[model samples]
Target chain A: MRKLSKVITIFVMVFLSVALSFAQGSGDKLGDQSKLIKTLNKPLTFVFIPKVIHPWYDVVKEGALAAAEEFKKMGITVNIKFDAPTNADISEQMKKIEANISARPDGLAIAALDPATNTRLINDAIKAKLNVITFDTDAPNSNRPLYVGHSKDFQDGYDLGEYLAKLINYKGKVGILSGSLTAPNHVGRVKGFKEAIAKYPGISIVFDRPDNDDLQKAVELTENALQANSDLVGIFGCNASNPIGAARAVKAAGKTGKVHIVGMDDLPETLQLIKEGVIDATKAQRQWEIGYWAVKYLVAMNQNHTIPAVHETGSRLITKNDL
Target chain B: MKKFIKTKEMSMFIALAILCLIMTVSTSTFMTPYNIGIIARQISFIAIVAIGQTIVLLTGGIDLSVGSIAGLSGILCSLLMTKMHVDTLSIIFISLVLGIILGCVNGILIGRLKLNAFIVTLAMGEIYGGLILVITRGYPILDLPESFAFLGQGMIGLVPVPVIFMLVITVVIAYILENTPFGRNIYAVGGNSVAAKLAGIKVENVTLYVYMLSGMFASFSGLLLTSRMNAGQPTIGSSWVMPSVTAAIIGGTSLSGGEGTIIGTIIGAAFMGVLANGIVLLNISSYWERVITGAVVIIAVVIDLLRKIRSQKE
Candidate 1:
């Protein structure tokens, strides 16, 4: 009985330590640097809320922090607070925004999960006199001053579609695996892809499915797609997870080079897969630029400096040769 | 033969057969060996997890932590291989042992402490799920060894390696449930815990062992998926918890306990696999796929319930 208690105690301690470590948000202090010019004396705090807690947003946070470091060199104290919901939930995100608003930060930048609902919240934040901006995902109808992120999701998808069509010589069946069916970005990409491929007389889309942003679901759906269309020659992944998932299925089916794959985002797994030749190319979004510019623009807004209504941090297509 | 035909497993098997028949007729590719192999491998992961869930359900307990354990185990195994440079065999052994230990924790909390199984496992599930995100930080562990891929992608005489593992697990577990005293004790405890204790059964020990087995099975499935994907994905098993329970329930496992079979769970999983595969093969719209799948599950359970009513009356 005593030994059992000891084992239980150890387990509980380990769990508590791990949980406590992860409780804090991904915010780090900037190093000290001699001031080039004493422009601002007071420390400014800004909060960035993304759709969910994902590695993609983590990269964005890195950019926001990098901007903070730049301001430190200018003798400006910029404190960045990064917070996001654990799951991609609208209500949870709304609650975070509300809480941050009440906290009265100098600025708030959000990646809208639902444009309709977030537009209302963004308006409310503006009414509260807080400088507001948007990033990654934009709520155009909102009162926010500027949007800093990639705005050409459809064009990027079209480019990928054209590339895949050419790779397959414009005469083979293709499939598309996207993230959520409702996400505007994913939907736009899918729409653009179908339009681009429709120009090819012989190329036809045989299967289209949503993996709901799950890697395993993406794998299963791709496997099923491959089985359903035995002669499928190309696949388009409309998000970060799906392309890697699709590549895994293609490799397992022993059709690595036989089937061409193009996808969105430059997740580490997706890049490795591209290097391995299992995947042909991916659309690399400028996540760091979006973060850096979001903070920069938010500071300008606070200082009453005019900023552009849209700051497009564009994306580029990455192939094996690019890597 | 009449008695066998009247069984719940028989009803489920019929449903599965009907699904397969519809797919085979609707799509020319559905019945081919290639498609069959894909379906078999797809179902094997869920089928393995459902086996352990079936045991826990037989004890009138639910194991919500199965999915989280699977995800964490896969991540840990990948980390060990990539960061620690551990050998594949030792890593597999270490992961299985870790799974057992994790399950044992749940068992002790619920079995020894006499806590509510639902609440205990649910909390444990959240803890394990959070641990995965913390460890991986929402990134997949990539660059697994090429040799490890055999566990997920290899074929032996037209059968997937994971499928073989699933079959072996099913047979061993089936034998234990039917032919062992411990297995019988599990049913008794679920049927009536006080009565089981009065009959000199160590109910706590049975509960502990069942949860341990559940953890081990979930971990094994996680390992197989990691090998198959050739990367340790943090989101590997997030979508599995609901399916694990659904598969057991569809296979005719009673929610109240002590009235399910291993064969029923396998057929249940296969039914779901065929349903998903058929939707794709028949070119069903993506928007309507979930609605159709949900409707099919309801119809299957209703048919099983009606069959049970008829058998009871007769």
Candidate 2:
């Protein structure tokens, strides 16, 4: 009986070792990998990555979540994954991208930080025959097959510029506050915004303050810009967080009523400011559609549904009327 | 000639001039008072933190917790003002002292306990960041007193209050770094711990004070930010870590310890702020701003390297 017990212990150890090695081998085989063949015999799975897990993405999350629920009954098992590089570093994001590809999901929806940075990853993902699309941010040069967000970042900027221009009745020495000047999306918007403002004739972006996505810097920049451009009659914040910082500075300077203010995103402060008439209106993009289409295409491609190369998500001009 | 020619200070000064020139030419609006004021005021936050970072960097160490500390304290002070019904005047004082305490803990762990400065501060940053989020749940504390807000937004005549704060801070810190006995001891400890210990300077105390000072500066930036926004936000200090390092590095300060200047860091901070502002003012797309920024950072480092090479040759 003792000899039999010893034999059982040795057998259990051998089984555990074999299982561990098998698990290890599988993990290394597909680390964040998206491969269509992996789902050929199983339920289809897809992962959607945003710029970061911001409250703004909550809307996108809802849209994707809803779609996943609908597709579950169709025998397509979709898994939603998320990651945020503490900062925008291409190499840092590449690690997550590599892991996603290695995991060998059926599809991937990405919002890359920069086109230049993701060039190599785009090459690898395409070579491996994985389905990919962009939402919110796009890698235009990369062969990602489809871009599901705004057709172009410049259009989004144009939309913002048009909204502010018409609201101010196309006349004012206006200042622009932005988060980062280097972001392709923001850059596109700036170009479009500048062109759109030219149509206004009287409206000019007197001072352009780039806060590097830092809210504190945003406030300081706005305050200085206001001081330097005392002739400024309006302010248009170019990103989600800039409006509050700009508005706060404007309010502090006792110029709330004297200057027209317009900004982006519906942060509680921006919403409050709009409600209180501190800011005229805000411009919101269809983040819900971005996430929805990104995930939908990812899942469909897994099921062998070949879709279009680019899916343009339009921006919504959210004035007090819409809110 | 060699000693004077290849100085880190000279290298950083040159980089600052080049960046100024590039931006000045690229954007017609870049050199205006409005833009200059924005850059100078904007740099104050990072410059303050960099002063502390410089101290840590001088000791051949780093502090990742400064950003978290700023966020955490910003939330705390804002909450106190808005929720606890505490007086804003008292709240600012509490935040400043809290900064010192936080820095002291970092100093103790690294200086006294002999822990790895990077790991200790990194973990502390996480712990503090989580604590801030856990307490506030990722929202800004609003409805701060105007008097409190005034400290951040109020200008004393033509100068921004924050820039004034920066100037005052740099002057005092510079004085200590160059003159005070305690300051001299700090240099000794940073230069060589064993040698300093043998020379009878209390190395542990000096190290402790430097980190504590770093925390205080971060807290000051947080308080100023709080006033600037008239709210306390948990996410306010998210990207501060890099700029603090960037300012210190570009200012001719070595990451390996033993040399630096508060003024140089202030200039570096201003340089970063100006570069970003110039790109936007030139009507460049916001997205391309990052490309320009990344390019500027690389250039600053390269310029520093060339200066080092030149100094070596001289």
Which candidate gets the maximum TM-score versus the true structure? 1
lDDT of 2 by residue, A181-224 (tens): 54656656667778888887687778876676667888898888
Give the per-residue Cα lDDT of candidate 1 at B128: 95
Off by over 4 Å in 2: A1-323, B1-6, B285-298, B309-314
Best by DockQ: 2
lDDT of 1 by residue, A149-191 (tens): 9979899899999999999999999999978754778988998
- At residue B238, candidate 1 shows an lDDT of 66
DockQ of each: 0.02, 0.03
Model 1 lDDT per residue over B204-278, tens place: 999999999999999989898778766787766666777788888888888888888999999989988777666
Please give the distance, in angstroms, between residue A230's alpha carbon in candidate 1 and its true position after superposition: 59
Model 2 Cα lDDT, one tens digit per residue, B18-110: 878987777565566545655666677778888989988887789999999988888888878777777767886898899999888999998
Model 1 deviation from native, Cα RMSD in Å: 26.6
Q: Which clashing pairs does model 1 show?
A: none
